[model samples]
Target: MHLADILALRPVPAAALLMAITRRCPLTCAHCSTSSLLSSEEHPAEWFSGFVETIEPEDRPELIMLTGGEPMLRPRLVSSIASAARSLGTRTMVLTGGFFAPRVPPALDDVAHVSVSLDVFHQREVPRENVFRLVHVLAERGVAVSFHVVGSGPDDPYLTEVIETIRREFRDGVPILVGRVRAAGRARAWATADERVSSDRPRPCTMAAWPTVSADGTIAACCNQDVLDHRPIPGHLRLGHVSSDSWRSIRTRCRTSPLLRAIRTGGPQWASGRSDGGYCGTCRLLGTEQEAPASPAIAYLEQQVIHAQLSAGPAGFMRRYGEARFADLVMLGR
Candidate 1:
């Protein structure tokens, strides 16, 4: 669907929804957000279905983004989501780690896109051969595919080769985005902050341009910025929880937010704090707002944090995607 259509809606209905079907993932990357440590929480299929029922009928986003610890871990989810959107003539999409790439999406034609996260450890976790095998399947099924790459670290010498390979191979016409690791949960628990994390370079987050819905059922201004950027672990209202009041306040505020207004008005200097400088500022702000930095242990963990800049060919591309030699991305689940 056209993003312009969503932009034209009254109250500008959330352009899309982002939901994390499951927080459980197989691959343990270093800078994972969500601080995703709670693996024992079993997400039921019905929970997903109920979440679906919560999206406001008027704002049924044309695109639905399913993410997770690794969304593919939840079997039959992609299919179910597509079916729901198709029932409303909308399209569904997913951000997978290529766990089930070769699998067929049940509701064949309703999927709009499938973004596969291809990082260095991808092969180790999901197996490399399986990823390529799945990508081929997604292509045949007509699901538009994009690559989400996590860059190689300064501590890891193998990263340069991996990035060059991606630039040469998968980056042609296919959308490419870069990202950095935030030592939220497991990453914070184990990984040490890398030198690359301290650059003041700027990056753009396009995810904000689209509407996002969280798994628990709340419509959000953007997915990546949800709880991570919000002050209070972000209330679940946007996830379809205590609707009306929360989002009523948030949505209204977003429309007038200087940042949002700037982007909408084509202000040359748009900022969601997507810079090492801004991220740092925002992080400090988060700490102050939550009284979170007091714990010496967490402070030490933040000290171990690494922030760096990446190359984004597209103007709004995120740069945490380190330069690496990974060209072949295997899509494991659809």
Candidate 2:
């Protein structure tokens, strides 16, 4: 599966599952999204594989994305999940820090796609050369590969330089998904806050569409780092935990929850009827408010919004959620 193929399904509800297999990472990059270290909490391997096992062949997501503070750390778990997902007709993708760069993990054989983290912050810990080498080997093996690049902003010189270099080195064989640094994890203290969504008009939040399995087995409605870190996840955003809930139940709640449906169609600002807090901030507050009553109109609106989003394609998704300047880069190797 190509990166664009995976991204195209991003807006669809329950189209994919994101599992953070482990939180422990060897590289302590300054901008680490999970602030992962060797000591960071990692749950039992069964908590992850058991969930994948629950995904019945007839009712499974189109894709299963494995992520972590570093997913490569648990090679065996990656292989297990990928093999099971594949058997159920679900494609699998892995996003890694490339700490094991220049050496392709054997687990990668079971996956369909691989995205390596390559950015200024990551380069401080993981050499870009080693990451490039790893990706090259994976590409040669017929496993689709892409780079998840991050920078300070669209105008960041680092983005310009690295993007050009990747294109040059790979001869445009590898696609790049460029995004700006967010105020999360280690970067929270310094990284500027992302622009807030205004309540004036409806702004659909695509992030709420997928279910994210966190390190401790808790499954959240969205992939926001804060939502994943909270001890008692907000009622509305909380899907059932992996330890107790089956994939069918989690996906059903994700699609049927009125609040999530509203958020996916009109965003947290409209769903919670407040935008004083930023996008995610307002989403967090929804737990304190009454759940949005379900209605046929809301359901209709969600389908309409998803249709419009599907029309926009992957590059369009990048323009809205990622840096617009490099949005088209996602289509580089398509």
Candidate 3:
């Protein structure tokens, strides 16, 4: 699948699954989101394989996104999971820090897309030259590829220079997803706090549309790093464990939960009528009050909201979730 195809499904519930297959990474980037290390905890390959085996062709997601401290670290496991998902008509995507450069892993040969993480922090560990070489190799091999770049903000000089460099190197033949550095994982110590949402306005969370499988095999309603890292996930955001929950069960809860619907359509501020602790903090505090079954009118309104977002298309979604300045770059190579 291409980058535009993936972003176009951002607002649809359960359109895809984000699986963090491992937490062990070779490099120690300062902004590592999962706080991955050489010795980070990783469950047996069976845990991931068994869960993927449950994906039926009729009930599978459109895509399966594999991530980790470094997903490429476990090439065999990545290939197995991708093969299983592909067998059920689900395409696979892998996001990595690109520790193995100038040598694409054989396991990724069948992956639909590969996104490499590139930033000033990552350059200290993996040279820019190596990352470029790897991307060229993948593109030459007929695999769709892109870059996931993080910067201080839209005006960061490094962000500008790097985008220019990539466009020059690839002649705008590759796409990029640019985002602001978030205060999660190791970056929490230094990354700036996210801009607070105005309590007076609604800010629907698009991230909640897809289910994310944490490194430990617990699935969450959204990809919030904090929620995934904490033990005993907040009652509202917790989906279920991969070890015990089937894809059908997780997708059903994600799609049918009234509270999750509220979060996606109207945001936590709308659900509670008052922001308790920022946007996501108040989300964690929402309870049965927001779990009322959706009336016919409410359900219709929810559908309208989803359709509206979908109509805006991928670039529009990027403008809302990613850096607005470079949002159009997501569709560059499409």
Question: In model 2, what lDDT does residue 243 have?
Answer: 89
Model 3 agreement with the true structure over 1-334: per-residue lDDT tens digits: 7899999988999999999999999999998888999899999888888888888888899999999989998999999988898889999999999999868889879899999999999999899999999999999999999999999999999999999999999999999999999998899999998855657576777888999999999999989888899988877899998899899999999988888888888888887788767888777677635564666665676788899999999999989889999999999788
Model 2 scores worst on lDDT over the 10 consecutive residues at 193-202
| lDDT agreement with native, every candidate | 0.47, 0.92, 0.89
Off by over 4 Å in 1: 1-13, 35-38, 43-47, 54-58, 101-110, 152-160, 163-173, 189-314, 317-334
Q: Is candidate 1 or candidate 2 better by TM-score?
A: 2
For candidate 1, the lDDT comes to 0.47
Instruction: Say which prediction, candidate 2 or candidate 3, comes out ahead on lDDT.
Output: 2
What range of 10 consecutive residues in model 3 has the weakest lDDT sum?
Answer: 288-297
* Candidate numbers, best TM-score first, in rank order: 2, 3, 1
